[model samples]
Target: MAAVGSPAIVEASFISRLVTRKTVMIGLLILVVVAVLAILAPWIAPYSPSRLSVVNRLKPPGGTYWFGTDEFGRDVFSRTIYAGRLSLLVGASVVAFAAVFGVTLGLVAGFFRRLDTPIARIIDAMMAFPDILLAIALVAALGPSLVTVIVALGIVYTPRLARIVRASTLVIRELPYVEAARALGVPTWRIMSRHVLRNLLSPILVQGTFIFAYAMLAEAGLSFLGLGVSPEIPTWGTMIAAGRQYIGQADWMTLFPGIAIILSVLSLQMVGDGFRDLLDPRLRKDL
Candidate 1:
C-alpha cells in the first residue's frame, strides 16, 4: 500500500471521496454556471443593467425583455446576471480576506496562552450581537460601498473563524508530533506554518464556505435596507428593494431577484454541507 502520508495517496483519496458525493457535484455544477454567467455578463447581457427606458417600465416577460423590466425599466435579466458578479465578488472576498487574517490571529492566540485571554474576550464581544446586525451597524458607520461592505462582513465573520481555528490549533499544539517538533528545536513559527497549519485545511475550508454564504446573504440584507453599495449599482438587494413597492403590481421584479439570492445562497450551503460531510472523520473512515 502507498504511504498514507504520500501526496499521491492524498490525491487519489480526494478524488474517490469527492466522486461519491452527489450533492457536492450538483452544487458545483450550479455554482459554475452562475460564475460563468457572471463573468460573461458584459457580453451576454442583452442590455445594460441600469439603462432606463420610459417605454419599457414594468414590462412583463415577453418580447424585448426576457425576465421583464423593473420599475425603472431596467432589464431584469441583465441586472440579475450583473448582480451575480458583485454578489459573488463580495462573498469570495470576505471569506478570503477574513480567513487569512483570522487564521493568523487564531494561531497566535492558541499557541500563546497569555494572548488567548485578551483575544478571546474581544472575539466574544464582537460575537455577542447577531452577525447581520453587527454588519449593518458597521456598514452604516463606515458608510456604504463595496469595500466597506467587504470590510464590514470580514470583521463580523473573523471572530467565528478565529474561534474555529483557535480550537483546532489548541488540539494540534498538544499532539505528540507537535511536542516532538518542539523538543527537536523546531522554531514555533516553522512548526506552525509547516506542520500545524497543514492539518487545519479541512476545517478552514468548511468554515470558509459557510462564511462566504453568510457574507453574500448579509450583503443582500444590508442592500435591502439601503446600506449596501451605491443605489445606482445593480445588486440583487437593490432590485428587491425597488421591486418591493410594486410587488403586488409587478411580482416578477422581486421574484427573480429573490430567486437569485436563494439559489446562490443555497448553492453555497449545499457545497458547504458536502465539504463538511467529506471532512468528517466517520465519513473518511467509510471512504
Candidate 2:
C-alpha cells in the first residue's frame, strides 16, 4: 500500500520541483548578479560618480574610459554603477512598503466582510488613475525629494497590491482550513495571520518582485522629468535628462545609463516571471 504523505513531504516536493525548473534558476541567477552589482557599486566604480573632470568631457568609449564620459565629464561607467544602488534601493523600499501596507489592508478586508466594500471602492478609485500620473501628482504635492519619491511610488503601487492580495485572500478565506481555524475559536487576527497570510505568501512575493521593477522604472522616469531625486544625485534618469541635449554630439552619456536601467528592470521582470511560475499551484502540480 502507498504511504500517505505529510504536509512537510508535500512542501519539500514542491520546493524541489521549483528548484529544478530551468527558468526559475536562470532568473534567480540574473537577479543575483544584479543584486551583487548593486551591493558592490562603490568598490566596483572606476571613479566618483559625481566628480567632474572638465578636460575629459564628452569623450567616447576608449581605453581610458570604458563606457566613456558624460556631458559633465563624469565617468559613465562609475555613474551607472552608483545609480544601480539608488535604483535598487528605491525599488526594494517602495515594494516593501507597498506590500506590507497593502497586504494588511487586504487581509483585514477579506477577513472582515463589513470592510470589503469600502476598501474595494477606494482601491478602485486609486486604480482608475494612471500609475505615472498618480506618482507625479503625489510627488508634486509632497515636493521633490528621495523620501517623497519613494513614498509617492509606494502609494501609487499599493492599491494594485492590495487588490491582488484581496483576491487571493477571498479564495483562501473560503478554504476549509481557514474555516476550520475560525471555527476553533481562533481570533480573526490569528486566523488571518496564521492561516490566510501563510497561504498568500507565494502570490504576494511574486507581485512584490514585479512591483519592484515598476518602482525602479518609475523612479528613473521621475528623475528624468526633474521631479525625482535631487539633480546633485547621479541617478540614471537625471543622467539621461542631462545627456539629452548632447545626444547628437555625444551618445554615450544617455546610452550607458539608459542601458543600465533597461538591464536592471529586465532582470527584475525575468525574476518575477520565474517566481510567478514557480509559485503558481497549478504549475507546481504540473511540474
Candidate 3:
C-alpha cells in the first residue's frame, strides 16, 4: 500500500487549492470589505445613526449627505454603516452558536448509536416546524429583544445544522482511521474529537457559511416585523421598516438599505457556494 500522507500535508494542500480559486478570492474580498465596514462603523460614519436633524429630514443624497437622511432626519448613510455592524454581528454570532452547539450534539449522537434514534427524532420534530414560524414563535415567547432574537435564530438553525453534522459525522465515524484510533485504545471522546471531528471540519465550515447568510436574512425579517433588536438600535431591517412609508416620495429611504441587505446576503451565499466546492475534493475535481 502507498504510504499515507501526513495530516498537516493534506491540510496545506487543501489550503493551497482553496486559495487558487478565483471565486474564493472574490468572496474573501466581499467578506473583508463588510467586516471592515462593521469594525470601523463608529469612525467611518459621518454622523450618529440616531442623531436627528429636523432640517435635513428626508433629504435626498447630495454633497451634504452621501446616502441622504431618513424621515427622522437621521443620516441614512450613517445608519446604514452602523447597521452593517449589527447585521454582521447577528449573522456571525448566530452561526457560531448554532454550529458549535449543533455539531457537538451531532458528534455525540453519531458516535453513540444508542442515542441516534431519539436524537434524530427530536431534530426531525424541530425541522417539522417551518423555520421562520419557529423563529417567530421562539422570539415571541422569549419576548422581542436582541438576545432573544439571537437565541431564537440560533435555535431555529440548530436542527438543520445538527442534521448536516450528524450525517457527516456518521460517514466519518465509519472511516477506517476512526476504527484504527478506537482499536489503539483511544478514548471515545478522543477518537471523536481528534479524528472524526477533524475530518468533518470541511463540511462544517461550508455549512457555517450558508448558515451565516440565512441568519442575516432571518434577522432582517424579525426586525422588519418589529421583533428584533430595539428600535433605538439602528439595523438594516429596522431602517427598512421605518423607511417603508416613504417608499414613494423618499425612495432613497428604503432603497439603499434594502439593497445593502440584498447584496450582503447574496455575497454570503456566493461565498458559501464557493467554499462548498473548494472544500469538497470530489467537487473540486469536477470543477
Candidate 4:
C-alpha cells in the first residue's frame, strides 16, 4: 500500500469502497442493463410491440413467444422492453421539470425572507395531501395524457424538492461565504446561482434519484388505474391492467411486466441509498 493519505491510496480506497458496496454495484448493473434495453428497444425488440395475432393470443411462455403473448397476441417480451421507454421518459421528464421549478422556488424561499412565508405556506398546503391522491387529482383535472401525466407528477413532486432545497439554502445563506458575497453586493441571482446553488447540488442530486424512482412508480400507478397513457400504449402498468382479467389463464402477461417494474424501481431505490451514503459527510465518514 502507498503511504497513508497519498493520492494513489485515496483513489484506490475510493474504488475499493465502491466495489464493496454490493447494493450500489448490483443496482448500477441492473439499472445500466435496463437502460440499455430501453434505449435499444427499437432495434432489440424481436417483434412489433403493437402487432396483433388473434390465433396466437394468450399463448403461454414457450419456444416461439419467449415471455408469452398478451390478450391481443402482442408479444409480451417486446411490449415489456418498449414499455421501459415511457417509464424512463416520464421519470426523466419529471426530474427535469421538478428540478427546474423546484430549485427556483427553493432558492428564492430560502434566500429571500420576504417571499419565504408565502412560498413555505404554499408548499405546506400542497404537502398536506397524500402524494398519490394529489397526483390523481391533478391528472384528473388536467385530462389524462402523456403530457398531462408528466406535468401532474412534476407539480406534485416539486414541493418535496423545493422543501429540501429551502432547508439547505436557509442554512447555506447564513454561511460566511454567502454572507460575504452579499456584503460585497453580489447580484441576488448571481449569489443564489453561484454560491448557494453549487453547494446545494449534492442534496439535489440525491433527491433527484429518489424522485426519478417515484415518478416511475407514480406513472405506473396512474396507468394501472386507466388514467395514465392510453391503453394502446404498451406501458408496463397498462400491460398488467390489460392482463388482470386473464390472470389465471395467462399469468405470464402480468408476471413479466410486474417483474420489470419491480426491478426498475428497486434498482433506483438502491442507487439512491448508495448516493445518500456517499454524498452525506456523516455517512461518508462512517464508510
Candidate 5:
C-alpha cells in the first residue's frame, strides 16, 4: 500500500470518496451513459432520427417503437438519443466561449486598476438583462441557427464567469506569492497566467458545470420558441415543440425528450455540486 500522500494513495482515496458519495456516483453514471449513447447514436439508434413512416404516426410506445412515433411518424427514441449530440455540443461550446472571454476580461479588470472600472461596468451591464431575454435579442439580430444560438448563449453567460473570476482575481493578486512575483519583475502575463489563472481554476471549473447545464436548457428553450436551429433538425426542444400539438394523443413524443433533458441537466448539477465540495478547501477535509 502506498503512503497517505503518495500518488497511488491519493488516487485510491479519490475513488473511495467518489464511490461513497451516492449522488455524485449516480450523476456520474447517468452522465457517462448519456454521453456514451450520444456518441454511439448513429449505430445505437434503431432508425434514422428523420426517417418518416406515415403508417406509424402517433403510435404509442411498444416493442416495435420503444418511445413511440411522433406526429411526423419519426422515431422518438432515435431522435431523443441523437438530440443529445447537439445538446452536449451546445453546452460545451458555450462553456468554452464563456470561459475564454470571461477569464480574459476578469484578469484584466482585477489586475489593472485603470481597466477595472470599465470592464466591471461592461460585465454588470451585460448581466443586467435577463439571460433568456438577452439571448433572444441576440438570436433575433444574428438570425436563428445553431451557431447563432451558441454565440447568443455564450455572450449572455460570459458575464457570470467574468464576475466570479474578477472577484477571485482581486483577492489572489494581492496574495504574498503574487506580490513576490511582482517584486521579482516577473512578466505581467506570466504572473497572471501562472499564478492568478491557476488559483482561479477551482471556481472556473465549478461554474463551468453549471454553465453547461444552463446552456443545454437554454438551447432547449430557444428551440422550443422556434428561435433556435431549424425544425428539421432533431433536437429535444424541437421534438417537444412538435409534440405539443398532439399532447393528448402522442404524449410520448414530448415525454422521452423532456426526460432526457431533465436527466442530463440534473446529472450535471449533481456533478457540479460534487466538484464544488471536492475542490473547496473548507469542504475537502470532510470528503
Candidate 6:
C-alpha cells in the first residue's frame, strides 16, 4: 500500500514548487519586502505616526520627511509604513480565520454529497449580497474595532473560499485512489484531511493570497468610513480620509497613502497570479 504523505511534506512540496516559478519568485520578493517593512516599521520609521508638528503641517515630500507631513503635521512616510503593520494584520487574520471555517465545511460538504446541497445553498445566499456589502453590514451591526473587522471580513469571504475548497474536494474524492481507500474501509477523516486536503493546498494557497489582499483593502474601506480601527491608530484608510480634507491644499497628503494601498494590493495580486501559474496545471500550460 502506498504511504499517505504527511501535511508538512505536502506543504513543503507546494512551497518548493511555488518557488520554482520565476514569476512566483518575484511575487515572493515583493511579499518579503512588504513584510519586512511592516515588521520593522517601529524602528525604521523616522517619526512617530501620531507625533504632531503644527508648524510643519502639510509640508511636501523632501529631505527629513520623505512623504511629507499630514494636515496634523504627522510624518506621512512614518505613518504609511506604520499603517502597513495593521494592514498586514487585518489581511493575515481575516484569511486565517476564514480558512479554518471555510476549508472544514467545504471538505465535509464535498465528501458527503447529502450535505452539499444545503451547505451550497447557504453559501450562495451569503454570496448573493456582495462581499464588501456583507462586511459593511456586519461591521455596522457589530460596531467598529479590530476584532469586529477581522471577524466581519472573515464571514464575508468564507463562502467563496468554501466554494473553491469544495470544488477541489469534489474532484479529488472521485479519483481512483480515493475510491480504493473507501473500498478498503479507511477512516473517512484520514482520507479527507491527509489525502484530499493536501492535494488542494495549491489552490488554497493561491486563493489565500487574493483573500489577504482583498481583506486589507476591505479593512481600509471600513476605516475610511470610520467603521474600522480607531482613528487614533494610524492606518492607510484613515490616512486617506484625513488627507481628503487637505487634498486641495496639499495633494501629497492623499496621494501618498493612495499609492501605499495600490502597491500593497498590486503586490498581493501579482503573488496570487504567480502561484496560479505554478500550481494549476492548466494555467501552467498557458504560461
lDDT of 6 by residue, 116-174 (tens): 99999998899899878899899999999999999999999888799999998999999
Which tens-of-lDDT digit does each residue in 37-97 have in candidate 4?
Answer: 9999999998999899999999998888999998888899999999999999999999999
Task: List residue ranges in candidate 3 displaced over 4 A.
Answer: 1-12
Q: How close is candidate 4 to the true structure, as a TM-score?
A: 0.94
Q: Which clashing pairs does model 5 show?
A: none
Residues 130-228 of candidate 1 have per-residue lDDT tens digits of 999999889989999999999999999999999988999999999999999999999999999998899889989999999988999999999999999
Candidate 3 global lDDT? 0.87
State the lDDT at 170 in candidate 6.
91
The pairs that clash in candidate 6 are: none
Preferred candidate (lDDT higher): 1 or 2: 1
lDDT of 3 at 15: 80
RMSD (Cα, Å) of model 2: 2.3
Candidate 2 TM-score over all chains jointly = 0.93
lDDT of each: 0.91, 0.87, 0.87, 0.93, 0.93, 0.89
lDDT of 2 by residue, 7-62 (tens): 77768876787688777677677778767877898888878888899999999999
Candidate 4 error regions (>4 Å): 1-16
Candidate 1, pairs of clashing residues: none
Query: All candidates' TM-scores?
Result: 0.96, 0.93, 0.94, 0.94, 0.95, 0.92
> Between 1 and 3, whose TM-score is larger?
1
Q: Is candidate 1 or candidate 4 better by TM-score?
A: 1
Q: For residues 1-287, could you state the per-residue lDDT of candidate 5 as single tens digits?
A: 67779978867877787778889989999999999999999999999998999999999999988999997788899999999999999999999999999999999999999999999999999999999999999999999999999999999999999999999999999999999999999999999999999999889999999999999999999999999998888899999998999998888888999999999999999999998898787998887
Weakest lDDT window of 10 consecutive positions for candidate 4:
10-19
Q: How many residue pairs clash in each candidate?
A: 0, 0, 0, 0, 0, 0
